[model samples]
Target: MSELGLPLSEQSLQQAHNGSREEVMRVFDEQHFGRHHAKRSVAQLEEELQKAYKNFILANEYKSSKLCEALYTRCEDKMDQLQVLRLPSMAKFNAGFLLCNRSFEEECVGPSKTIYEQRMKKMLGKSRSLFIKEYNHRLFNWLVAFSLVMVVMGRFVIKFILLEIGAWVLFIFLETYTRMFWSAESLYYNPGWHFIVAIWETLVYSPIIDLDRWAILIGVMLVILVLYWRCYGRRKHGGSWLLPLYRNHEGGSNRWRSD
Candidate 1:
């Protein structure tokens, strides 16, 4: 990682240099050579100054660029490690945000406020767009989740839950018939393998679900879907119920608030 870090550092430094070079040249040409001198005549001298400054930095070998590269590598390592962990995704996201902010400030913001503002604005705009895009994604996810809930309820409970012991006996007879003729697995398949495993692990270690739990699960999901839909609709149109409504202390209604 350290070996790789050096070249990454060099590239970032080069980018930093490139971004500021024209601005630096403009200022140097104006101040050093004065406005009376022709701008085209100073191009060679400007290139010399840029090369000298870069070479001097390399010769002196400052650690800021290297530190930025190390920080980036560490952040990448953390992300890769977190992918294997069961920790909450939000926590991982926050950690990543912190890492970027740290690296950005350390590497780029030290030069000038103008540079910092441009970098920060670009970073923040990208983040805001990403957040909105993810919000839209979660709405679709909620619809899928609700549909899955309905499918599970219809398949397991509505179809099989009311069957009596007589039905079981019939199923056994059919099983015997099928085993003799067809030579295949049982007809009544359990779709919830993970849920069954969870129940078993709970009893041995927490409680398992039986046949009667589907209705209650469906009800809970319905309530969740309603809440999610309400929130999602509000957010899509620039309102949010999750955020508390406070009387504007700034002495204004919606328009004033926007301003």
Candidate 2:
């Protein structure tokens, strides 16, 4: 009730304070039901009364502390009821797997900025700074530019340079995530139908969903491909300039042949 600063909310809370428990509950239910604008609600109202209990505790608190145990009680029962109705996936009110938003521990009450890799998530989404942080590294960018120029000249195999090295970093991250269950308490900890719903929220977005992005990415990929085909920076006799392990040696012309 302290959180309700709005005039309407204050009025509703005041009404609850003055009315009988049953009357207060009826009003609360009416407000919740009307707020949702649900024509026909499928989920059952929770019989365990919370609003009434809150009022009861507050009214009796001045008399004795022993009569009220508000601290031990859950606070989001109304919010939870509204949330169940808002979810649109099922015919009946139910959360699916992977993204059920259910937690073993209680979530925080106040809004907090979400951080990803030391940058604010909202900023990262709105800007290219996170992905292109290395643009200031002149030597690295120069090398990449040189490689792309080589790709344009006629050696197609140069594209593999990044793929092979990138795989090592990707492998390390994947291995770390696979072992994260102990600390993170991943959905992997609970295997059932609901677990599928729990994971969906985490995977809310993917780049492939947008056709414009797909076309732009494909265009860039094609350009990179053609450049690589023209200049892969391979040796005269054939072999990668950077990767020597698979290079042709002793008059062997086969670039892929490793003796």
Clashes of each: 2, 27
lDDT agreement of model 2 with the native = 0.36
Each prediction's whole-model lDDT (CA): 0.46, 0.36
Q: Tell me, what's the RMSD of every candidate?
A: 23.3, 20.9
What tens-digit string does per-residue lDDT give for candidate 1 at 61-140?
44444454455456555545434322123333444567666666656422233344464556545654554445323422
Candidate 2: where is the Cα deviation over 4 Å?
A: 1-163, 180-246, 250-259
Q: What does the lDDT read for residue 187 in candidate 1?
A: 23
The best candidate in terms of lDDT: 1
Pairs with backbone N, CA or C atoms under 3 Å apart (clashes), candidate 1: 202-206, 203-206
